[model samples]
Target: MSQHRKIYLASKSPRRRELLRQVGIDFEVLLLRDAPPRGPEVTEIVLPGELPEAYVARVTQEKAQAAWDAVLARRLFTLPVLAADTTVVIAQEILGKPANRDEAISMLSKLAGNTHQVLTSIAIKYQHQLLQCTQKSEVTFAPLSDSQIAAYCDSAEPYDKAGGYGIQGMAARFISHINGSYSGIMGLPLYETTDLLARLDPH
Candidate 1:
């Protein structure tokens, strides 16, 4: 069998690294110091009342393109670069990383005893070719008391996670059920990500 293609991951998320390792893909971290400032694209389609799926896909694509540009500018490794973005949605509202403890608690309160969708979009870019995919998972949470929310917020786990919870961390107890890819909910969808890489490698 041929060797798998060397790859690069353009992210700082530990969860993404763990997921990629779980699939046995040989890769290196692609860190870009001058990467374009990350943010939502300002477009007519991203205005208020826009669909979450479309918005997230656009964001991921933008991130991938930005990383690709950075790689070219810096003369980094010439390999497939992967980038992704994950967001949590509840009743049409997108819940991104919490800015502060109070915001995290508020997000958790809204998610309590309710089902929300987690959307993760991944992009792979090599040379001039690009491929993108998205995975959505529905997660239901148990009713959380104020104390539970406060404790979790104080633990430093929710501060960096979307939806104010880390499914694989201390917040696992709060999840009652999940209706889709667990890995996707964690930040990176393993199957989809690996499949995309396979297409690029074809070995």
Candidate 2:
């Protein structure tokens, strides 16, 4: 097996890209333009009765598999593919990316003065082998006023993030504390990710 100095990132998220670059990992963003278009089945739709951890891991694995197929189709370098997914859960109910400002406001309203679980599942695949893991974080929010929620909804960040918030963004003011990996809340768990790479590398 050939060792890969650079891996293929299967996400377009700038946060994930920055996280990898910040750690000095050389990676190329896999462009779906050349890959076969995906259907809604490949999307992050939570299944009925699916727990947060299960949902996140399933989504990450799905993404990694799709990216691997794309890499083969594009005949790109024989590099491993990395993919990840993050979601928020409160009272066992998943709160995904809000569709509109109204929904963002609603999600934030429910999260005020509440603690929720943030799960980020990551997957890396090379040939027939696949390595996967999940990072779970508990984030507590300060009591928020309606005005604060509305003000945040007006901004453009919430729509693209799960639980209608980003821990590393302006939403940091809303978070009182986090009990687990901070990077995991941002969508990728840096420690777990680096560890996976080190273990997967055949050097």
Candidate 3:
């Protein structure tokens, strides 16, 4: 593999880092406190009349642009910068990170014994060019009992996850089936991301 190019990951997600590492993609994490804050507005937290796909895509773009700006301002690495945002949707309802244990339980209950969509949007910026893509995965959950929900919520895994659960964590027992990219649901779509990067930086 050609190692002349550098890649900057504009995210603090360890899961994303692990995913990239699994594919042997050499990259460095970009940590800039100056990056734009993730607010309810930018995330579009299930507005009264908003679409789920559009909402997630918008947030992904916002995050990518913000990271790009930060990298440019700091004169960081000259290679491409990657950013992504993931959301869980059930019956058109976007379930983001819960604010408290009660809310986490409520979100888990809503997803119990049902099929939901996990949408992940990825954006890549290099020089003046930008590329964005959204990948969707359908995941089926087994009927979750109250005790199970409580136990999962009490764990530290669900606090920072978008759907109040992590597929690779304690919640894996609750997942019956998945019909799309597992890596995408985890936060980054490796196939699409690698394909795009190959096109941009073919060695």
Q: List per-prediction Cα lDDT, in the order shown.
A: 0.84, 0.89, 0.84
Give one digit per residue, the lDDT tens place, for model 2 in 1-116: 12567899998899999999888888999854423454342677788888888999999999899889988988887788999999899999999999999999999998999999
Stretches > 4 Å off in candidate 1: 1-4, 33-47, 201-203
lDDT of 3 by residue, 1-203 (tens): 25426688888899999999999888898764643565332344455677889888877777777777878788875667888889999998899988899989999999999999999998887777788889999999999899999999998888899989999888999999999999999999999888778766432
Which candidate leads in lDDT?
A: 2
Task: Name the lDDT of candidate 2.
Answer: 0.89
Ranking by TM-score: 2, 3, 1
The local lDDT score (0 to 100) that residue 26 gets in candidate 2 is 88
TM-score of each: 0.90, 0.93, 0.90
The model with the greatest TM-score is 2
Residue 71 of model 2 has an lDDT of: 89
Runs of candidate 3 exceeding 4 Å displacement? 1-4, 32-48, 201-203
TM-score of 3: 0.90
Q: CA lDDT of 99 in candidate 3?
A: 86
Candidate 1, residue 88: how far the Cα is off, in Å: 0.2
